[model samples]
Target: MGLFSRKKEIMVGNICPKCNMEFSEPQRTLRHIEKAHKSKKKFECNSCG
Candidate 1:
C-alpha cells in the first residue's frame, strides 16, 4: 500500500537580517538582533584569573 499524507508546514514571518533566524513575533526578532548582533558584552570570564 502506497499512501502519502498531505501535511504541509510553512513559516511566514519576521526574519533576522544578520542571521537567517525566523521568529513568529516581530518584537522577538528585533530583540534577538539587538541582543545577539548589536549589543556587546562588557565583562568576560578569564581562566587564568
Candidate 2:
C-alpha cells in the first residue's frame, strides 16, 4: 500500500518563497526562510504577533 492514502495535507503559514513550505506560525516561517530557503526578504504582519 502507498504511504499516503488521502489527499494532500494543507499547512498554514507565510510562504517562504524559497522552499515553499507552509508554516503554522510566524517565527517558524521566518526560521524556515532563513535556514532552508535562504531568504533575506523581511516579513511584517500587522494582525500577527
**C-alpha local distance difference test of each model:** 0.73, 0.65
Residue 19 of model 2 has an lDDT of 59
Q: Cα RMSD (Å) between model 1 and the true structure?
A: 11.3
Model 2: per-residue Cα lDDT over 1-49, one tens digit each: 9786996544536766565777778668776755765436477778983
RMSD, every candidate, angstroms: 11.3, 12.4
TM-score of 2: 0.40
Which stretches in model 2 have alpha-carbon errors above 4 Å? Answer: 1-13, 39-49
Q: Per-residue alpha-carbon lDDT of model 1 for 1-49, expressed as tens digits? A: 4388664543335998778999889878867876898566777679754
Task: Please provide TM-scores, in order, for all candidate models, with all chains considered together.
Answer: 0.53, 0.40
Error of 1 at 32 (Å): 0.5
RMSD of candidate 2 to the truth, in angstroms, is 12.4
- Model 2, global lDDT: 0.65
lDDT value, residue 25 of candidate 1: 94
